[model samples]
Target: MNRDLLGRHRSVLPDWLALYYDEPLEITHGEGRYVWDSEGNRYLDFFGGILTTLTAHALPEVTKAVGEQAGRIVHSSTLYLNRPMVELAERIAQLSGIPDARVFFTTSGTEANDTALLLATTYRRSNTVLAMRNSYHGRSFSSVGITGNRGWSPTSLSPLQTLYVHGGVRSRGPYAQLGDAEFVAACVEDLEDLLGHTRPPAALIAEPVQGVGGFTSPPDGLYAAFREVLDAHGILWISDEVQTGWGRTGDHFWGWQAHGRNGPPDMLTFAKGIGNGMSVGGVVARAEIMNCLNANSLSTFGGTQITMAAGLANLTHLLEHDLQGNARRVGGMLIERLRSAAAQVPQVREVRGRGLMIGIELTEPGTDEADPRAVSAVLEAARDAGLLIGKGGGHNTSALRIAPPLSLTVAEAEEGAAILERALRSLP
Candidate 1:
């Protein structure tokens, strides 16, 4: 059955849309942290459908809300006064930390980011945008234009004149040897130098933690340092929190909080996990930036009633249970366990990330060269051992990504770690 579906999928779907595994497994259903393949094989899902399932699989609150909302109404254009949309928007506005916040919903992170780009360019009145080196914003033409990772970017032409910046990864590049404070200073100097060379960029867009860039992050307060520079130049700061938002990072509800000394970002884009598998994405900004568009705009299915219902329920459950705290506790144990396990493995170059968004970077034994083959082997072995994970990085896709649902338990974390440990050990 899985083979038949694979054949059908390949026949119809774009070849560029990648699927995991040597033999891709079709997940039929899920419960809590586990999912069953079409053939009845169960695996502990650590990646959580690219970290979309926030709280749990088949969460009762989200399920009930989705069902109830669908039974009443599902499709309503943004023109109407949708109660669920209004409620979710109010909650996000309060949580966003932006003064006089306004929210606009979209169907995916790509659309949300595109909306943000529109707002920033219009408000700042500049097409030049600064993006972090080895960063990925999204896949659409507009979002892809600012993406700095060559592995994910397919085109050179763009509507926006994008300038790539440094300091996304703290442990690599020329500043790797510097102390944290020195590193931040160096990146700020680099930004200042770049600003001197180019037309004033409309905004500097960055991921608080570069998701597709192997879960890499600069030292704390690095963005705050950059924010000071951008503030002086009147450039917007757009934080792409699609993967790092909603307490997934453990220590903060929003990833931008790590750099909150300079205050919230001028614009923030979010998707994935908020709706817990439902298509709900949006951008939040201060009224000045958000209301910059003079032309009217509307999203056909942006804040449709059903997705908002799911978002409201999921957000409520996440906050009520304090899943951020759960992510911290369980993810802390998991990363420590993985780190201890990787310490003995020469191919493991680094273990990094906060909360449940951990990454294990693989390198050739005793060399700096990325070992994507070893990562592939480990992924296959882990799947054979009844564990599911994800992979992403620059150039070679060398980092193993482990982002489980926030409701992960200690026992489950232990079990996943054991499987991953064995997979790493099985590497040849």
Candidate 2:
């Protein structure tokens, strides 16, 4: 527990392990936008545990719900319906805007993606699934299969590729902006070409905002184009809303809205804020599509009583307090502030994305820094200066994904952006 305590010893974790330890500022506890280390050193949680702790860590209402539920029932088999699970399902269905939807709950985004894969496979009995290049669905086998990124599926695991689409929510503006119309036309053309060349795909999956792909938000037209293509060829659009749901996108409660407004997807996947800070994820598909649905659960009651209690409390907090509105207010403030901040820093490449989900791309390959390294070095420096951030892009291309809680204040947003700006300027 005392790694650097008393200034006597460094941490003892093994170096050979595949551990991600970029944090120079260790974390022990968190509340709102702040975290404390074992030494009681405070750091701003701008990363929000990579945007999963939607309500922020250890919220009072969430704690009360869990504590009260623990005193009652922590878990119950999914075989018998639990009250908390039932309530949680109802809440998710109501919030998701999917009519007559059924919930297949899971513990993590990876598991939820796995469930989506199985359901898609079972429903269509087709061997094919499609996802966008540069997408990160999850780490499990099937999820990894649909994941267009090669890292998720190693060369050894490569079995004829699932077919990678060119433009994703995140694929645009790495160097140049892809017009919404061109991107849409390309998707239609690809689907038509793929359909003619091979069998029709059973399912097509995509993130509304590519979380790991650098907060990529596709232009408003991509969804409609996809829907047209899918409908023409009898494929389903499985919207991976894992990072863009639960009102994180500000303008809408879910990123699918940018698409759903045209028409709802055949299936929708969600995670992150679904349970606030607790672990909960789910899939909502057209009732008829899952009509042949059989419970294919790998999770221990992906719908557990304790998790449900936390989920309900968090959902209630979101609805009652209008966290989505807060996300819009604060997210816009952060975007505007970062725009100004980046203007003063030459290393900043671009600022893009919507609502609470945003990103700032830096000069790739560390052109500004004196010592050459991934431009993500700015992230490490920011963390040391007491602000948490996450970096992404397949080739270590420079970009930081910022999906803070809807509860983040404008003051906190400014402070966090200031930290990021200073870190970028201090490059070298």
Candidate 3:
């Protein structure tokens, strides 16, 4: 396909497509950190297509790798061993620091998560699964059941079947303030009491850092405490790094790494940036956990030929370009700038997150509705100023989720922040 900037043409969008919202822009092409439209206008992509385009669009090296692999072998079945598939799995193991960690690659994070659930249940012989409130695992039946967000309807969840724990409430935001110290400690104490009364959980899954819930990282020592509690109960601790892994978080290659002695989990799921822009995700299971692996038990096709090729290419790109290093630098800069901006503007309750995945939260000012107007004001204004962003949270409030490509330049970050600042000031 001769991919060029979108031609000047009006798209007759499908009427059958469900509308999540009334407005949807026609983005034409993307490269690096900017996207252009059919109208020949450019919008800086802070949203990075909800942070999926980690290496940017139409990246030459990644594309070339995909092309070459495609020409050679477009598909493969699990009945055979594929070179790229093995290589990709090896790369994941090395990057993840989990020795003897067996991987079950899949087409998406949700699939990997589902696979993790299967592994957890089969291995432990438990029925009840535990997850955080306001946390998003995926939209699939099992994942949605495991997901804690109330936005999901009963059609997708069995609230009676799954147990939802609090990720901790935001007294003022930054969640950093509520970190595992007091609030989390309270949760731990309460949870111990709850577990004492309620049924035992099969697995306790968590987003190493909350992704769709506004980039909320856990407070200090929180993970360690949670780990201890889960360990004592023989519950599997699964870290959902679908959004925070592959070096998006500064310093540690994994979000859990930054939690001091909190250490790793029994199982870890990674997606998003791992395959660069390609769609691929996998579950990294520790050896003790993998002892329960049953081949006939899992899906037919995982770690397929095409996806493995893309994943390898992505790993190569991260290593060669040092995107993780850039993520740290840019993420730190973004946090500093946002902290300063939020302080100056009381409307911004808190600015929290690590690396490029940052969130600018807008409190209700006085109500629980969260004043989406404040968030919309900033986002809409940014859009008018030629910047693209995203909104997420159970309340659908005004949280500006700024997760650009890890390759995002400081200049781009500065421009985006300025645009946001201008937008917030214009808010009434």
Candidate 4:
């Protein structure tokens, strides 16, 4: 039955839409941190649908909110006043940290980023932009141009002239050998040099932790240093918090906060987990930048009633439960356990990340080259052991990504880590 469904999916879906495993398992239902396949095999869900399920699977609060809102109204097309949308937007604005912040909703991170690009370019009146190396923003054409990872970028044709910058990946770069302060200085120097040779860019966009680039991050305060340079040149700074937002990083509610010594960024784009799998995304910017456009604009399905309700409920639960603190306590233990297990496996090049977003990078033993085959083997092994995880990296796609729901318990973390350890051990 699963094979038949896989055949149907392949036939109807785009080839670029990849699936996991040699034979894809059809997940039917889920609750808490666990999901059941069509064949009734239960598995612990660590990837959380690519980190979209922020709180939990089958979260009663979100489900109830969605159902109640749907029963009354599903969407109002952003034409009429949406109470839930307004409420959600207000809450996000308050939390965004951008002074006089205004929020505009979208349906996905890609669209949220697209809107951000529009705002940045319009506000600064420049087509050129700065992006980080080994970064993945979104799949939209505008966002793709800014993406530095070759594996995810499909084409060079772009609406904006994007210049890839340094500092996103700290472990495998020219500045990798330097100390933290020296690395920041080197990246800042490189940025200054790049700026001297190129057109004045509208903005410098980055992910605090590069998501698709395998959970890699630079030294703390790197962005704060970059912010100083950007401000001098009138270039806006945009923090892409799609994968790292809503306290997923544990120590910080937003990923940018780690590098926020100079205050918050000029604009912030978020998606992924906000709606807890309900497709909520948006851009938050100060009033001046957000209202730069003289003309009118509205997302047809962006701030629909149903998605807003879900986002509100999810955000409430996340805050009320102090899931961020839970993530910190639990994820710390999980990382330590995985690191101990990885020490026994030479193929495990590095185990890195913060909070619930972690990555185990694989390399051929004694070599720095990425071992994608090893990643594949561990993924298959983990699935066979009733664990569901995800994989990502730069051009090589060699890193195992583990971003469970923020509500992950200590026992679940330990269990997942054990399953992952066995999977790594099984890797040849």
- lDDT (Cα atoms) of all candidates against the true structure: 0.94, 0.75, 0.75, 0.94
For candidate 2, give the lDDT.
0.75
lDDT of 1: 0.94
Please, what are the lDDT tens digits per residue for candidate 2 over residues 1-428? Answer: 35454233244554432323343444678888788877787778877877888877788889999999999988777877688888888777776677788887888888887777777777877768778877888877777777765544553253223877756743443322546676667666866787788787778888988888777666776777778877887888888888888888899887888876557787889887867767888888777765666765345768889988998888888888999999988998899888888787766767887888888877643353222243557767776787777777543444677878779988888889889888877865
Candidate 1 clash pair list: none
In angstroms, the error of model 4 at 127 is: 0.6
Going through the candidates in the order shown, the clash numbers are: 0, 1, 0, 0
Tens digits of per-residue lDDT for model 4, 291-356: 999898888999899999999999999999999998898989999999999999999989999999
Compute the lDDT of residue 49 as modeled in candidate 2. Answer: 75
Error of 3 at 220 (Å): 2.6
Superposition error at 413 for model 4 (Å): 0.7
lDDT of 3 by residue, 57-104 (tens): 777777888899888987777667788888888878776767678877
Q: Worst lDDT window (10 residues) for model 1? A: 389-398
Model 4 spans with C-alpha error above 4 angstroms: none
At residue 359, candidate 1 shows an lDDT of 95
